[model samples]
Target: MKVEYKKASLGDIQVMQELVDPEVESGVILERSSDEMATNIRSYILAYVDGKLAGFCALHIHTASLAEIRSLIVDETHRGNKIGANLIYKCVDEAKTLGLQKLLSLTYRQSFFENLGFVEIQKESLPEHKIWADCIKCKHFPICNEVSLIKNL
Candidate 1:
């Protein structure tokens, strides 16, 4: 199971949408329309196994010094193979390349993220500019179950 991580293009949106649909329906991940994904295509990184899409993660720049790691999902069949960790490594590498100081995520998998060296932080500790813009659109806004985690790049 050779896994490759690559920058996503408009052509990948449909597949990515399909990959995330179930999680969205289950309310575990937020719903993102294809149009919204296409509009933000540059922020996405996709993982493929043997030329088939396996999972995806996105690094969305929130400010010069900060970025958010979002939409990280591994196909159900591919869980526990370290695909998720590889995706996070790609995002963290990108963050370092961009000279960003931190990478953050709002995730339900707190222990998993902790294993990757991310530390839990109070949501309010995050930059208001980052939260106010995107977190506001989250279904759990104002009372999100997702915990905030950050890794210094």
Candidate 2:
């Protein structure tokens, strides 16, 4: 399973949408419009396996030293292949390249992130900009059930 992780292009939006749809529908992740994703294409990294889209992760910069990992999804058929981990690694690598000191995520899969060295944290610890920009739009809003996790880059 040769997997390549690279920055996502505008052309990859549809494939990325499909990869994330299941989680969205299940309410495990928030739904994002294709247009919104296209606009933020440069913030994303996609994983390709044998020339097919296998997974994706996005690192959205919220401040000079902080970034949030968003929209991490792996194809259902390709789960358990370490593709998700690779996508995460790509996001962390990009964060390092950009001189970011922290990466955060609001996720249901706490143990999975814990295994990757992300520590569970209080959502309030995150910069207010992140909440104002993104989380406010989330249906979960003030009642968000997702656990907040952070990793020092």
Candidate 3:
């Protein structure tokens, strides 16, 4: 299987939404509107396998020193291909290139992020700015069950 990775384009918004729907239903990822995705489109990285969109992820830089890996979803049929790992590596590369010091992820899949070198952490350890700016807007705020993990880059 041939795999290619590229920055997301405006045209990919619908497919991106489609790819993330199941995860959203299962609460693995937050639901994103097309407008939101379009606004942050540049942060997204898309993976294509044999000319089809297989998965996608986003590297959201919250501050100069911190960034979060968000919206990582691999199509069910595309599992086990390492596409998810590669998408994360791509995010890591971007974070490093931009001189970010840390990457954070809030996920239910602790072992998966741990395998990629992220260490489990308390959500309170995250910056207050992040809490007020992003977490506050989440429907699960203040009582979310997702695990927090960080990787110093």
Candidate 4:
């Protein structure tokens, strides 16, 4: 199967929502509002398999030294195809191009991120900006079970 990667555009938001909402409902990803998706649409990378949107991931820059890999999701029908990894690689490339020094992932799939060379870290080790700006808004905040991981670029 051939997978194509591209930067997300405003027109992709509806499909992005359709692809992400299931994961959010299952408590696997954070909920994203339409406004949020429209505003940060450019930060997202989309993966297409056979010309259909199959998955997505985003690189959210928090500071010159840091960015978070967020909202990674692959369609259930497309799991195990490494489309998710390709999405992540795209995010990593974007982060590097922006001259960011590190990539962060707050994830439930610890082994997955670890397999990609992200090392486990204490949540406290995350920048305050990340905690205040996003984490605090997460429905699972203060009791979130997601593991924090980092990869130096």
Per TM-score, the best of the predicted structures is 4
lDDT to native, each model: 0.90, 0.87, 0.92, 0.90
Runs of candidate 2 exceeding 4 Å displacement: none
Our model 2 lands, by Cα RMSD against the true structure, at 1.3
Residue 120 Cα positional deviation in candidate 3, in Å, after optimal superposition: 0.9
lDDT of 2 by residue, 63-134 (tens): 889899998889888999988888888888889999999999889999989999999999778787777877
Clashes of 3: 0
Q: Looking at model 3, which ten-residue stretch has the lowest summed lDDT?
A: 133-142
User: In model 3, where do residues sit more than 4 Å from their true spots?
Assistant: 136-139
Task: For residue 30, give model 3's deviation from the true position in Å.
Answer: 0.8
Worst 10 residues of 1 by lDDT: 130-139
Candidate 3 lDDT over residue span 77-118, tens digit each: 898999999999999999999999999999988999999999
Error of 4 at 34 (Å): 1.3
**Per-model TM-score on C-alpha atoms:** 0.94, 0.93, 0.94, 0.95
Q: Which of the numbered candidates is closest to the native, going by highest lDDT? A: 3
Instruction: Report the backbone clash tally of model 1.
Output: 0
Query: Model 4 lDDT vs. the true structure?
Result: 0.90
List clashing residue pairs in candidate 4: none
Estimate the TM-score for candidate 3: 0.94
